[model samples]
Target chain A: MSITISNISKSYKNVKALQDISFEVKENELFGLIGPDGAGKTTLFRILTTLLIANEGTATVAGFDVISDYKMIRNSVGYMPGKFSLYQDLTVEENLNFFATIFGTTIEENYDLIKDIYVQIEPFKDRRAGKLSGGMKQKLALCCALIHKPKVLFLDEPTTGVDPVSRKEFWDMLKRLQQKGITILVSTPYMDEAALCDRIALIQAGKILEIDTPKAIVKHYSKPIYNVRANNMYQLINSLNDYEYNHSVYPFGEFVHYTDKRADFNQKELKMYLETKNLTDIEIEKTIATIEDTFMELAK
Target chain B: MKIILYIIQKEFKQIFRNKGMLPIIFVLPLLQLVILSNAATFEVKNIKFGYIDNDHTSTSRTLVEKFNASTYFDVLTDFPSEGLASSSMLNGEVDVVLEIPQYFERDLQKEKYNSLGITINAIDGAAAGVENVYVTQIVQNFNQNLKVDLLQVSDKQIQPITIETIPLFWYNETLNYKTFMVPGILVLLVTMITLFLSGMNIVREKEIGTLEQINVTPIKKSQFIIGKLFPFWVIGIGLLTIGLIIAKLIFDVPMVGSLVLMYFYTSIYILVILGIGLFISNFTDTQQQAMFIAWFFTVIFILMSGLFTPIESMPEWAQILTEFNPIKYFVEVMRMVMLKGSSFIDVLPQIIKTFLFAFIMNGLAVWSYKKTT
Candidate 1:
């Protein structure tokens, strides 16, 4: 295993940030911690990177105990926090060179590892990190984190504020990094990004609700879902919630993803009920459960 | 060692690149050195003088003429009565009032003793005290001359024995306040700049979240701290050099001690300040908080540093408190070496104390700094 966490719990004052969170990521696997804001994803990452100590339980990164062998873990792992944590006053090249030098290596030593990402921002090598755009800043942060070419990478919501196009490009970079045999433990609030991981843990309020392959996790939903659209998205959601047989109703991008309480739910019945409520242009069709539907169901 | 060097290089880069900070580090302190040494003075002058001649005799007129001849007193007005003198003092027209009593010359001739009434405004006690000294010296000179004149008329052969003491002021012979103050103010500039800058440096990283990134690295605590503080240490020395140059060129303050010794002492002294700064940065989270705390300590240290006030005049308890003040030792060392031409052995006690302070403060700073919490 590249990482192992068992019964890890942490609390700050009265609020418990993480509670009995336990999971593992195999070597070369791309693992994701899927949750909303304040879902203990950052707390978990801090614990694994040895930036914070868990109040209870134990975690090991790269076969080194996070507490006893923290030095080894620090030496072998790379971390990019959610916040942009580079020297803003330093130029892009300086920031990269600094991180590399402090890690007892040089950019030339691992040029092959970061060459693909570095080339993108090479034009702005002399520009200070603070002057870079949002996407460019994230790219530089990722490059700094990967300069050491470590065995594991901990990226905490690296795409939270990035544009969609740059976000896709960032994910592509991560895919290539994984191909180079680096185990990645990433967290994201975006559920669509969760499917790109080899395995994911659906987390909410400091607790892990489910952990499995994205395909398997969605299969675990065990309920039929319908993509129901109408002229009025608000009334369609309201009508679905008002129906007695409706198990759940959520607005998911131009449609209401709904589940019926009964195992044998009738689509025509749901449409007839919506029409009665004066909700026109109602279109209901059976759709496969996505990772988002699974997460929402598990979160509920 | 190489890591520390790299961190130092980065720090220098950031410091030079900051447009708003370069003047603060270099220009402001030098300006303060020039302005403060010239402005903060101890010698009081331009005392307004007034007198009432109750006896219209030559003796009283001669006494009044003595005060008029002195450079310190302005001799502004001659009041006709004690009431007028009191009113003039109350109106803030005069600082000193001398009332020669009635029959002043007759009493001195018949009884050989007479008292004169002298009043002084006591607001700004230090200046008033200086004014009183000037007044007494002038009156005593007049009395001495009167005694000589009377002795020659009364008995020519009898000569009274008198003791005269000629005091020589060493090092600062002219009692130049600027010469005394220049080196002390230089200490303030060096201490304040290094403390404020180093205090805010690490906390800035914390505020910007780079501290968390660095914490996850494998860098040792000692290496990071040494690297972080070394740049400010250099700035402190650089400031001392610039301040010394200003002290020599602008103020004409003496540098009697070896230049090498001053640099050697300042190099260690800056470590003590940098250590305190690092300790403060370890506890604070924001640059503003660090600056506030740094400013608080700086104000206290500057006042208690004996730069403006003599340490001997401070209360016993406050004097004891100043022993722990690092600026006190620095001010003392600067004056001793720069003015007194003291040797290494002369300043060894201060060197030992400052080195111990550096060791303890840096130790506490390193111990409190945690890579994980």
Candidate 2:
């Protein structure tokens, strides 16, 4: 395992940011910490990356203890923080050179490591980081982080606030890095990105609810799930929430992914119930579970 | 060391690239040095004088002429009545008012002694006290002149044992206030520039999110602190050099000692100031908070550093409080070396105190900073 976090807990005064979070990320694995905002994803990432100290338990990254061997971990890992943390006043080329040099290497020595990502921004080499668009800034930050050719990489919400197309391109870059034998640990609030990871952990409220491959995590959900929709979406939602045995009701895209606690639950009965509420054009169908369905099931 | 050099290189590049900050760092200190040096002075001049001379005797007239003759007093007017002189004093037209009673000259002739009623504006207590001294000195000179003019072999002529003493002001002859203030003000400018820059620089990085990147790196805390402070240290030294040049060319202020020694003291002193600033930076989250804290300490340090007031003249407790101020030692060293031509031994005590201060403060800076909390 490249990262082994055992019973890690942290609190900020009165708020318990992370509590007894335990997980392991294997070598060269693109592991994803999947959760919504404030779900302890960042707290875990910060602890494992050696930027924070966990109050209870231990974390080892690259076989180095987070506290005792922080220097070793710092040297072996690259972190692109949740925010764009590169010097905003520096030009693109200057920023890249500065980070590379500080890590005791030159840009020429690590040209190949950052080439694919740097080429897109090579044209704006003289542009100050602050002036770049959100996507461009993300690309530059990644290049700076990777310039050292780290053994493991930690990306904290790298795709937040990025355009979808640019977000796809960033994931592609991470995949290429993994092919180079670099273990990647990335966190994101977007559920669909979970499928891009080798294994995923569903996390919420300072605890991990499930950890498994995206496909397996979905299969791990034992409940029968349904997609319910109607011409009056809002009224339909209220009617279904008022259903006698509905387990969970959350909107997914144009439909609501729902489950019911009734063992003999019938979709025919649900549709009949919505019709009496003056809802028309109803669509109900059994759907295969995805990571989103699995996460909602476990989080609740 | 290489990592530190890279950090320093990056810092210099950022500093030079900031167009708005270049003039502020390079030109503003020298400007303040020249303009403020003229304004900050202890030498009291231009004391406005008005007196009521009811007797109108030669002695009283001589007293007024004596006041007019002294460069310290302007001798604005002679009021016929005490009421008129009091009115002038209330209007703020005169700083000192001398009231000679109707029998003033007769009293001196009969009683062999006379007292002059002198009222002074004490709003600026220091200036008022200094003006009183100047008036007493002129009156004493007139008393001697009276003895000679009277040609008295009387009982008063027994000749009180008088010791004639000549005061000689060395180093800064003519006692030009600028000569004394330029070096002190230069120290303040150097201090303010380095402190504000170092204090704000790290906090700004924290705000912009770059400090997190630096923190997660494998760089040592001491190395990072050194790298962060090196640029401002150079800037502080650069300011001192420029200020010294201006003091030489414009103000004709003397630098009788070794320039190399001054630079050496400043190099160590800059570390103390930069260390304090970085400590403030590490504690604060935003540049505004950092600035407020830096300004608070800067104002306190400057006021108590003996820049405007003499440390020796302050109350015993206040003087002891100044002992902890690095600026106080620096001001003393700058003047001792620049004006007095003091060699290494002459300034050894100040240098040692500053060295210890720099050591303690920078140690505190490094100890207080934490990459992982």
Candidate 3:
């Protein structure tokens, strides 16, 4: 295992950030922690990176104990915090060089590791980090984190504020880095990104709801979800929620995903109930379950 | 070693890249040195003078004329009655009021002794005291001349002997306020700028979230701290150099001692300031908090530094408090070295104390500074 966390718990004052959070990431694996905001993803990242001490339990990264061998762990991991943390005054090239030097390595020594990402923002090498667009800054931050070529990389919400195209490119680069034998533990609030990981842990309110491969997690939901749409999304949702057999009702993009309480659920009954209410053009069809559906089911 | 150098290089790059802060670091202190040294003075001048001549004699007119001739007094008004003079004083038109008694010079010749009534505005006690000394000197000079004129008329054969004490101001012969103040103000500029800059630098990293990123790196604490502080140390010395040049060329403040000794002392003195700055940064989470705390201590340090007031005259307890003040020692050392030409051994005790301060403050700062929490 490249990372091992056992019963790690952390609290800030009265709020529990993490409780009995135990998990593992195999070597060369790209693991994702998928959750919404304030879900203890950052706290877990900080603890594993040795920037914070857990209130209980223990963890290790890159085969070194987080507490007893924190120094060794620090030397072996690359952490990109959720916030943009590079020096804004320094040029992109300077920021990259600075991180490389502090890690006891040089850019030329690890050019092969960061070439794909660095080349994307190489034209803006002279521009200060503060002046770059959001996408470029994210790329530069990734380049800086990878310049030292550590054994594991921890990215906290790297795609939170990025555009769609850059977010896709960022994940593709992560795939390439994983092929180079680097273990990666990343967190994101966007559930769609979970499918790109080898495995994911679904978390909410400091508790892990489920952990498994994204496909397996979604398959384990074992409920037939129906996509229901009408002229009025609000009225459709309200009518479905008022149905007697309704188990769950969530708006997913253009359609309302609904699950029934009974094992032998009747779709005609739900459609008839929405028709009586004032909603028009109602359509109901069985839809495949997704990671988001599984997360919603487990969280509920 | 290499990592520390890289960190230092990065720090210098960031410091120089800040366009708004460059002038604050370099130009403002020199400007303050020139403006404050010339403006902040102790010698009180241009005191408004008003008097009532109840004596109505040539002797009283001569006394008033003496005050008019002196540069220290403006001799603004001549009141007909004591009440008018009192009202003028009340209205703040005059600072010193002299009332000659109704004796017309006859009492002086007959009794061989007389006293004049001198009223001074004591609102500013120190300035009032200086004004009083000036008034007495003029009156005493007039008395000396009067004795000569009277003795010639009455008895020319006998000569009276009087005791005289002539004070020779040793280091500052002319008592130029600028010469005395330039070094102290230079100390203030150096201490204030270095303390504020060093204190806010680390907290700026914290505010921007870069500190969290750096904390995860394998960089040692000493390497990070020394690298962060080294640039400000150089800037502090750079300020002292600029201030000294200004002191030499503009103010003509003498550099009586060796320049090497001043630099050596300042080099060590800056360490104490940087340590204090780092300590402040260690405790604060924001630049604003660090700045407020730095300003708080800088004000206290500047006031108690004996820069403006003499520490010897403070209450015993306050005097003891100043013993712990680092600026007090810097002020004393700068004044002693620049004005009095004091040698190394003369400032050895200060050197020892400052060295200890640097050690303790930096130790506490580094110890309190945590990379992991």
Location of the lowest summed lDDT over 10 successive residues in candidate 1 chain B: B151-160
lDDT of 1 by residue, B214-273 (tens): 888999888988898899988998888888888888888988998888899999999999
Residue B192 lDDT (model 1) = 94
| Pairs in steric clash, model 3 | none
Give each model a TM-score.
0.93, 0.92, 0.97
Model 2 lDDT tens row, B31-69: 899889988777788889888888888988898899889
* For model 1 chain A, the run of ten residues with the poorest summed lDDT: A233-242
Pairs that collide, model 1: none
iRMS values for every prediction: 0.8, 1.3, 0.9
lDDT of 3 at A5: 94
Alpha-carbon error at A300 in model 3, in Å? 2.0
Per-prediction tally of clashes = 0, 0, 0
* Model 3 ranges off by over 4 Å: B81-84, B110-113, B151-160, B371-373
| Local distance difference test values of all predictions, in order | 0.92, 0.89, 0.93
Put down candidate 3 lDDT per residue, B14-56, tens digits, no spaces: 9999999999999999899999999999899999999989988
